[model samples]
Target: MSLFEELLKWDKDQCRVVGKKFELGSWNKLSEKDRLGMIGELIDLLCQRLKIKDKPKVILTTLDNAFGAFSPSENTIYIDRKTLSKGGILTACYCST
Candidate 1:
């Protein structure tokens, strides 16, 4: 299989493993610290699933017309804080992927 196909399959498998632990909409009720931790975990999971070697740092910030943004200079991801309700952290995870 092609690399993209492998990664897509990997992501689906990982999501199955993760889904067992988290119910739909469960990402919303976590505390800020827990949410950040979860985001970090998602990043790690994405790295493994997508085979990314250089993982970018994640930061939450206000944004306009964007769910997430990336800074190549600093190798960081800026997640829109406003979008983080109702399983919104999944948006951040998608951005990481």
Candidate 2:
């Protein structure tokens, strides 16, 4: 199955496997650059699939209520750092979707 498809099959707790597939080790072991790069790749993948010409910017922050949010007005996607720290890129991608 495609990575995205595999990701969709996962629950929040099982999402760390997605990071391992990308050779990111564990979420805590991932570096900032790698995390951002993964997010960028997922966003690009999503945009390409949707035929979206303008890719949105990704912002990582601490959030209490949400895992991620996409703002069409600013063409930006905001991801909670806690999600990354705990669930890794797969969870981020799932949240973005």
Candidate 3:
């Protein structure tokens, strides 16, 4: 099956990780608009999970996809499987934007 399909099958007990090595230069290649768009999507996902029918409280936890050698950028946001399942969000799309 495809990687996307595999990730789609992930359950609360599973952990998703990225094994590729990335450099700041690679990230810097993206336009500022693209970065903002990515960040916005993450924030929207958080809002969806909090079920913000009007206004809601949100707690976001972020981490690198790597095992332990690297960290996400200061601005990157993440959610683990455990927290994601407990949250009200019904679907997840990884690297899909």
Candidate 4:
């Protein structure tokens, strides 16, 4: 299976095994626009850390079940809204990279 498909399957499995939900901090309590801005900043930090010349496109989606995924072919990163809502930006960022 493709990477995306594998990620999707993993996410589905994760949803079935629930533990304590992620906590939302003050930073995560910000407005949607502000949160997206934070995500952009995180992406910049990730690119710098990874020393990637061509930065991948970052997309936040409510439809996706996964916390985050990187598509090498599209050079894009997908982060789930649920993750951000749960104050999981750092987790998502690490996973994406």
Clashing pairs in 3: none
List model 2 lDDT by residue over 2-38, tens digit each. Answer: 7668646545543443434454345456677777776
| Candidate 3 runs further than 4 Å off | 1-26, 54-97
Model 3 lDDT per residue over 1-97, tens place: 7755654544322221220111234334545444334334544544454444433223344435621121234333344434333332322333332
Give per-residue CA lDDT, model 1, range 1-97, as digits (tens). Answer: 7886675565555675555434446766677667667777777887876779999898888889998788999989887877654455553333123
Candidate 4 local lDDT, residue 75? 97
Assess each prediction's global lDDT (C-alpha) against the native: 0.68, 0.66, 0.36, 0.59
Whose lDDT is greatest here?
Answer: 1
| lDDT score of residue 58 within candidate 2 | 87
For model 4, the superposed segments whose C-alpha errors exceed 4 Å read 1-24, 90-97
For each predicted model, how many residue pairs clash, with residues at least 3 apart or on different chains? 0, 0, 0, 0
Output the worst ten-in-a-row residue range by lDDT, candidate 1. Answer: 88-97
lDDT of 1 at 68: 79
lDDT of 4 by residue, 1-97 (tens): 6655654434433332211122245455577667777666655654664557898887888655678888999998887888766676644422321
- Which residue pairs overlap in candidate 2's backbone? none
Candidates sorted by TM-score, best first: 1, 2, 4, 3
Better of 1 and 4 by lDDT: 1
Model 1 gets an lDDT of 0.68
**TM-score, each model?**
0.70, 0.61, 0.30, 0.57
